[model samples]
Target chain A: MARSLTKAYERVKNIDWEPSYISAADKYVEATRFYLPKKALDPFKTFIREYFLMEREKESRHYALLEAASRLQGSNPEPRWMEGMKFALSNLSAIEYSAGRQMGRMARVVAPMELRQGYMMQVLDEMRHTQLELNALRHHMRSWQDPSGYDIALKAAGNSVGAGIFRALAEDFSTCDAVETSLGLQVLIETAYSNIFFVGLSSAAAQSGDQVMASTMLTIQSDESRHMANGYATLMTLLQDDRNIPLIQEAFDKWSWRGHMGFEVGLSLFADYFVKHKTESAREMSQRWLLDDFYGGFYKKLAKYGIKEPRWLPDVIRNSEWASHTAAVYLFGAWPVFYHRYDPIDEREMEWFEKKYPGWYSHYGKFWEAYQQMTDADAGMLVTKELGGLPAFCQVCQLPWIFPRPDASTGSTIEREGRTIAFCSPACKSIFENDPNHYSGFKTFYDLYDGWDLADVIVDLGYVREDGKTLMAQPVLEPRRMWTVDDIRRCRYEVTSPLRKTAGVSAGGSPHSAVP
Target chain B: MSTEKMWIEERDIVGVKLIAGEEAEAAAAVISESYPDAVIERYPAYLSIEAPKEVVFDLRQISERLGRPYDAPTFLVIMSSYHGRINVDDDRITLSSEIVRPE
Candidate 1:
């Protein structure tokens, strides 16, 4: 009865019933990248055209992303940019650019005619984001330094930031089909972190006395929210096929970790150190936006649809308080070599950290005190000489393996492709294990170190000065200054004063100790 | 893996958390009057308001306090965060976390 089934299949293929020269594997992706080709079949043409018009109509409001970003419209708040602001602009610009690239790729990779519209709109939204962020940078830069600083920051820091975005969108690069790309890009990155990145950043901005930036960021968050809704709608459609649940859960685990890694660095730079005047620490903001509002309200509703939470949710919840704080110290310690300003936590600020974070003082209080003494001794301790090498990088997030100490860092170490690769956390390890091919072979800072001298590694990451020094402080303009003892001296640490006795500080814990 | 074990029938509650602001002083007064039995908890920079199972944010009352038109959606910006499903309209925003069973 089943005579020659293999031979029958071969005969059927030779019969040439296929639609076109394009193989079945490549058709859907090639066809749906943007608008379906004018030559494509009947209803698809009409549907794509109609959907395009609707998306254009929806995005008409995105122009408001620019005009004085403060809530009270037409208030004409002055533009301001500091070292932290430069760091933010650099990191944000890189992310927005990567977002546009990812969404454009999503449009090509997604197949269903019904879903193409959402990906297309997200493509437009990401473009609008690029424009909006540029406008913010330009507006503030007019009053700050050279016009070329923008170009310099982008070229210099693009590698690390772009690499982070690339690996974060690993599902997009590696998936055999479309489901995970949309979920990772649209739902996790835009939906979850938008609340933290845009909403929480705006709140922090407003409290720190820049009503302009707050308003602008809030306006951007709404567009991001709409994108999230579109993603949620896509989830609804995917749920119609029960087979998709397991795939969705897998994508959630892979991506939410990367999203967590990304925002931890971006938000903490601003919340913890950059904006001296504080509103919410990164932990509080995560609990507010991601945990309380997002999980409590949004994801709780998704339970009715049978989508379980990410498998790594326990680690995500437990580590939320310390991850960003740890990142702040790591980035701060790395200083001019790293991509942000390193503002020392003054005495009053230390008190606030203890009060706000509870265990924060026990966790990072000693490190900051050590940083204080290091500064007092050299004043420019961050200069190229004192830092022996970069911290060991997590293979997944590209962040340092700098989780809070006194506990072995919780990242899973895996033997993959004959090498021991380290991850920053269990969540990151799961992401790597999900598909090692997507993450492997990329240059970590460790890889960079392996290839070049430490100074060359610094220069490769965009820290180069025209004088050929690898360590240049930010606000990268004509008068490129190095971090001085005076910069450390200004903060109210007693060690900074020559009159005070320097005693009872945990002298430099070798940077190697922080490595996982 | 599920909230069933942690769920308490007696302690069923709905809550809204908001950051401290100029309007919060006036807004809190109006919100308290509506849910007189609601418990309000204040932290360093934010405050939380909770009732038995549902709490209504009256836009009419909020508008009267602020002396201007108020939109339910704008509360998203003013409030830091909230728990429970929120349904909004011109008149009110209701947040409810209770489970409903068929008779």
Candidate 2:
């Protein structure tokens, strides 16, 4: 009778649930409270001492759990050579687990019920992943005296921004805007992080030959791809809203710039960290995937919504295809800060670029030189001055700041409109011209017309209420969360760009080696 | 800083408008459960969502029960999703998505 009972129980437990699926949604959400701030006190106290005390205690508890998880027997004998596995496993566990929790917070704000449930499921899966990875790392952790720096709290601050942005979209932007920014923009971010950073980290771990990282990433990314489908689906829903058409149009123009800037930052960080150790590198793939997989894919999707591509889209596309522009941008901005920690640039880096495109090296090298002169000769004045009040708006976008450029015929320049319209290259001018109503007659461009006056324009536009003395501008004019013209201009000189040429462009120019 | 030192803070939330969807709300029900001391004040969709600190949701969950994708990534694309249809006027996250579901 006992044997018969045991056999029956085993048979019942063996059923696979994948094909005949059911969502364990509540289970997923409950599991997330393990890591996430189940109560508000946690996030608000992120900068406080009690949080540190709680973290230290929590760390100790987790360490004990880690030890308990390690001693259990596995499917095979514990080998002497598997010493490093524990450390890698623990780190991966923390990273992926935190990523899942962050996804949950983000999902609560934006994702519909089904998607939110899926994210919760992902959270549960990630917990299992952490446990498994820690088991893998246990052998490695035994040899090491301390394993402190791998805490997710430290990493979460940086990565949590993605989650934070997601939450903002759910809570802040319209459903249409929220869906576009959270789903579409995040797909780009996640795709890049999975490919560039996490994949590299996984490969660097010694026992990575099982290719477990790839398998795990592939699994998570399949979900991400599905999320992309949902993003497109929500976008279709948003597009059907007549009132939101202009908002969507306006958001596309704005967020595209924001997305590109973020992409550049991510690419630069990856190049500094991962590609540093290699003879031949993944630089080309890194550059291409960001533009092609992300930006290119994004633009194609947006076009289906009756939204035309931004004029500068082509230029951003053309620039990303070559390595030279990145060289210029990095040299002036991020590269210098990065090189302080790495090996000097090797001939191998340039050789790889040349191999990818025979003349890409020589052509861009010269362009860098010219860009350097342009930057040096026109440094201070061309960029807008930082001021207290909102700066002048662009004629076209009715936003602030444009790129500054030198006239080919004469060194003399024009600063006609209040906006400091600094063109990174000449190609952008036509983009500005194409939608003059949207762009022109911003406080700056309108001033150029002989008859128009700021006072009358402001009054007619109801800059002041019925009370004439009050300069109560439209709330739109009030500062809100935006990547303003000033922000763009700041990013221009501040971030490394490929257009500018100069060796010091990035500190200690040449592709920087990786951080150990 | 002590956990005791931290005070409950109030925040506003906002969203853009859409069609077929006359209005949307992003209120959190478990405010005390989540933030023990915090007191949340609710408002119309337009004024509150954009306030300094908030935890907002799409309210899309109420529309369906199963087989929906309501994760973080989908929410990020909300702006792009509503292009051409629901105009995000000055304050409100207007609902312009045609009301296929019955009120």
Candidate 3:
């Protein structure tokens, strides 16, 4: 009665033809080092008609929920998560859009019909994900009690210092080899790490009383399996030739570190910091999803093909121990620069953190104590200034060098062509060394605003509300008196680059690098 | 087959994470019926159905259990994430730790 999907997919794939007018090199603009065989597997065997029908059904269901949520205005969403969404959704939408562009690039350069077909569907999936995030953002903007941050979300993704991490990630994957992009993004990020964000944190979203975000994350994650299939198909095709093994290994090495720093660290922050009622700590989630599931379950199987564990797996394990806490410190320390309303972790949360991460209070306790004291605008103390200013962002990862723990930072500095470049870890340093030209051109946050006044930087970032004077960011969710541009000016805090101050220093000489 | 040639490992666990809802409950019910050894872990926001080595989702069975028509695409809507290699046809979707060699 109905045409078999496998037969239809095979028939559709047969339509692909070799062009006589142009060479294969010309047709595929980007060249990959990984050898791709002509034959590839499409495990899903996705066809266009079925794909559209499926996507349409999913979209209708999602939009219907969105409509219901809008009309009903039922749940009392946690303000902390709602505020965090301004930052999270902004970067997520941009990342998804970048992923869409990457899919287009992969579809063009990758020769296999099956892989290309999957990539085409993924292009639409990425676009849909972006729209879904934007819609969630729009809903929050319209519904949330505080809308200042949501209004400038897209703008913040471009300018916010913390957002540089995600931007670097998107840029790295988009610019790398087409096949490597699939490995980095789909296989590593989408398959391995995204569950922490989409599934694990979607639970956090629900627990935080944001059903819309929960729905959005779950729906977006549904599409990721297909994307993962696409990556697997490509990897399998490449693996058919023995020549591609080393190249694949190298890509895995670089991306494992990159994906951790750029993506997982941020998700960890959201999980640990954003959600009010947290079930699992970021460390615990990493243990379950990343270490146990991805590595033990999926990657161990790849050993048969001579694919070894990622070179940076041990380093990633070490970094994951303290990544979220360090990230939380960075975000809270430089709260004025970001667009979210932060709710400082209380005694309850502190106890939880210490329980989850043993001895957490020893390293971070003082900072939170200092943060609480400085919340009052009348105190004339900016926490950024109090904490001896923000550390230098790694040239490659775009995260601060004060990682794992600021006390025991794995960060190092190298003098390249008379300019000093900082790296968060040896992995990032090795990545930079591998292709100095690729990462060298990018500028850090301090490079742009080293000597500028704090107020001026905020104004320049356009993180101010409609009044154009009051900052969109507040020290706390609800302050007795909101800190304005004038309040920041009153504090007289000047932006200083740690890299600029310690230019020629070899390694681990950064000031204020002692917090975990 | 020799151990080295075997794509599937003894410790390999295939799983599907479904958004917690009536549909997920129904799917879990169907899966538990077929794979008696399946481990179903329920969370606040999702249901995790895991089986060692391999698991299969037959839409026809799911439809019958759901008391309505269900399709592969609709099943995908509930499944947020999965572990192990996945293969999907119109009526059936299989997740196995074993890598199916390409023809």
Candidate 4:
């Protein structure tokens, strides 16, 4: 007969004893503002031995699939999805590694035995997730026909301007209060946003013929339930003290917006734009997974404990209407700056988008038309230059000011210490206002490359393959002539900071005006 | 904008998303048998099973349906993700909308 898990867990709980030699403060190096109680729930009742055995089984199963994928070399994956993986996998692995570091920090500072035990397992889980993504990157690099983008993925993730969005998110979660990190990462991101990525997008991955990625996403998602439980356990432990309610509310308010802008926005972009054979729009996925499942199912229950809905949920819902289209504009417009081969959406997809979004074609049709025309390198046209240059990126979200829609942007600007700072939405502005110092230090894409030439910026980012002259990013997946450094230099487009031009401007300035 | 009350419907739906496979099919069969009200939605990559208020998965029943010896941890292997408060004992895993208080 099997041993009772409840009894085993109870016995395991007895093993913790206060150290006589070291004080609690000295023992736990970091301090969290959120109060943690002595007791917490570990619903999984995870034993380290069982955890390893379970994980080992999972790893063997996933790796066996990967191994088979490598040996069998099945159907050709969709080039659009394959190219997008260069950007997605790179940022994902970095985020996972940062999450692993956060777990270690949380295990140290959080006093509860159950939560800490869960955190310890999560630490390993995160590390495994990181390696799993890196392995996926390696697999794609080895197998994918055009390996230029894959070859430079990790480096590009560090240096590319678009990747700054993910970096800002990872850094924000990494540097915040340890317990707050739990709410932001585990409660909000892992629970709500990851479903869209792992379950929803993995379907897209399978449809796009990337079985390896589908397997990778599903396997990674298996670990997230435990992480969600970790967050729940921590939240429940914190709620025991009445003092923590307001603090919890504050954290929820901030992270809800932060997670949406920082994480969900990017995933939405991938879902709507990357997958060639689309199963669902980003809006539909958000409606189902985030709005219906997370907000409706989980968050409503939190009201019993005095936790209200996040302050920025309305804005989140509003932004969801056009977040993907705007993000698509940013990535597509500034193609040279990124590290992916572009696949512009066709008439079929545009019709699909219009059908799904109602007015998507009217708002975004002209841009796609111009993009298709400008794909020829011989034409000496760069779409980034033609679109009156890229707009100013929001300092808080690290996305461009033209979000939701370029024509009707909710983005605003504020002056702090005589310097102009832009925010994508009222939510972001409020987040920055909460802790000006925390966000004030972040440098935007324009900050780094305002005066540099377009060619030099790409060259400096090291977004080039082994043959250093050919650029990693192209206007289209397979261009008639690949736009090299020389080709970009011919365009003579210099990178200019939109914020610099619009300095001293008030809150309601049009993002479109700054484009030129 | 929709009202918060409208968004947060009174129905406390609890769900588990399992990776699409034989295990998911078997689990879905057991769940349908156990909880007649369970709604199983099939997607290309996974199976989404939702029930009103609560859903219980008995590993013994699942194993019987699968014609193999399945345990709780192995059951977790197929479960990609889930929402609602989760409780796992030796032989069963329960997903409930009930708020569990700390001891």
Tell me the whole-model lDDT of each prediction, alpha carbons only.
0.54, 0.32, 0.86, 0.87
lDDT at position A347, candidate 1: 89
Question: Per-residue alpha-carbon lDDT of model 4 for B1-103, expressed as tens digits?
Answer: 2112224353488989998999999999999988889999998788999999999999999889889888888888878999889998889999998887786
Rank order by DockQ, top first? 4, 3, 1, 2
Ranking by TM-score: 4, 3, 1, 2
Residue lDDT tens for model 2, B1-103: 1111112121122122111011222223322333443344332111112222232333344223223433222222222111111211111223221212111
Clashes of 3: 0
Of models 1 and 2, which has the larger lDDT? 1
The CA lDDT at A442 in model 1 is 61
A395, model 1: CA deviation in Å?
1.4
- Per-residue error (Å), model 3, residue A37: 0.3
Candidate 3, lDDT over the whole model: 0.86
Expressed as tens digits, the lDDT of each residue in A12-75 for candidate 1 is 3233233588875575444321221111111111123333443353344334434434234444
In model 3, which regions exceed 4 Å deviation?
A501-516, B1-10, B100-103
Which of candidates 1 and 2 reaches a greater DockQ?
Answer: 1
Comparing to the true complex, what docking class would candidate 2 get? incorrect
Model 1 chain B worst lDDT run, 10 consecutive residues: B1-10
Candidate 4 residue-wise lDDT at A206 = 88
Structure candidate 3, residue pairs in collision: none
Candidate 3's displacement at residue B16, Å, is 0.5
Question: Model 2, which residues run further than 4 Å from truth?
Answer: A1-112, A115-180, A191-223, A268-273, A276-302, A310-312, A322-341, A357-516, B1-103
Q: TM-score for candidate 1, please give it.
A: 0.68
Rate residue A6 of model 4 by lDDT: 88
**Over the stretch A45-97, how does candidate 2's per-residue lDDT look in tens digits?**
01123223433432343345445535542323212112222222333455455
Candidate 4, residues A1-516: lDDT per residue as tens digits?
256788999888867878999998899888788877787889999887778878888999899999999999878889999999999998999899999999999999998888899999999999999999999999998999988788777887788888899999998998899999999999999998998999889889988889989999999999998998998888889989989999999999998899999999999999999999876788888878888888888887889889998998888888888889989988998888888799999889988898788878788888888889898888989888887887878888899988778888888887779888888889999888988898889878877888899989888899876778788888888888888888889999998776674445532344454231
